[model samples]
Target: MSLDLTLCPDCGAPAEVEWRAVMESTDGPVEHARVRCLRGHWYLLPVASLAGPGCRLAQSPTSFRE
Candidate 1:
């Protein structure tokens, strides 16, 4: 994983990534991260946004079931 930092939308605290994976979405495969902030706020964030410019989702051989 990249050494990128995500901020909590609610408290503006630094958020920690708990889990990350590419999931199937209506638009196609999208990378998402489960994150929690120092303030204990939890939320889901799109990996692409945190990945910086020119970031792309890698294709995963393993499929995920909802």
Candidate 2:
């Protein structure tokens, strides 16, 4: 999986793109990426929406606590 760098929508920190794939959804094939921030915040973002203007993480993020 190729890694891409993006800003964490929640923390505004650097995030790492874990992987991307096209999934079968009700609408159609939607591309998504799993990203993790330096603060261990995880988010699943739609690839297309990332390019749109004023894209922000309005949804709550997922965090795995150890």
Q: Which candidate is the best by TM-score?
A: 2
What lDDT tens digits, residue by residue, belong to model 1 across residues 9-49? 57665666678889998999998998787788887877765
Q: Report model 1's TM-score to 2 decimal places.
A: 0.61
Off by more than 4 A, model 2: 1-3, 51-66
lDDT against the true structure, each candidate: 0.61, 0.67
Clashing pairs for model 1 are none
Model 1 misplaced regions, further than 4 Å: 1-4, 51-66
Error of 2 at 12 (Å): 1.1
> lDDT value for candidate 1?
0.61
TM-score of each: 0.61, 0.66
Candidate 1 Cα deviation (angstroms), residue 38: 0.6
Q: Where is model 2 poorest over a 10-residue stretch in terms of lDDT? A: 57-66
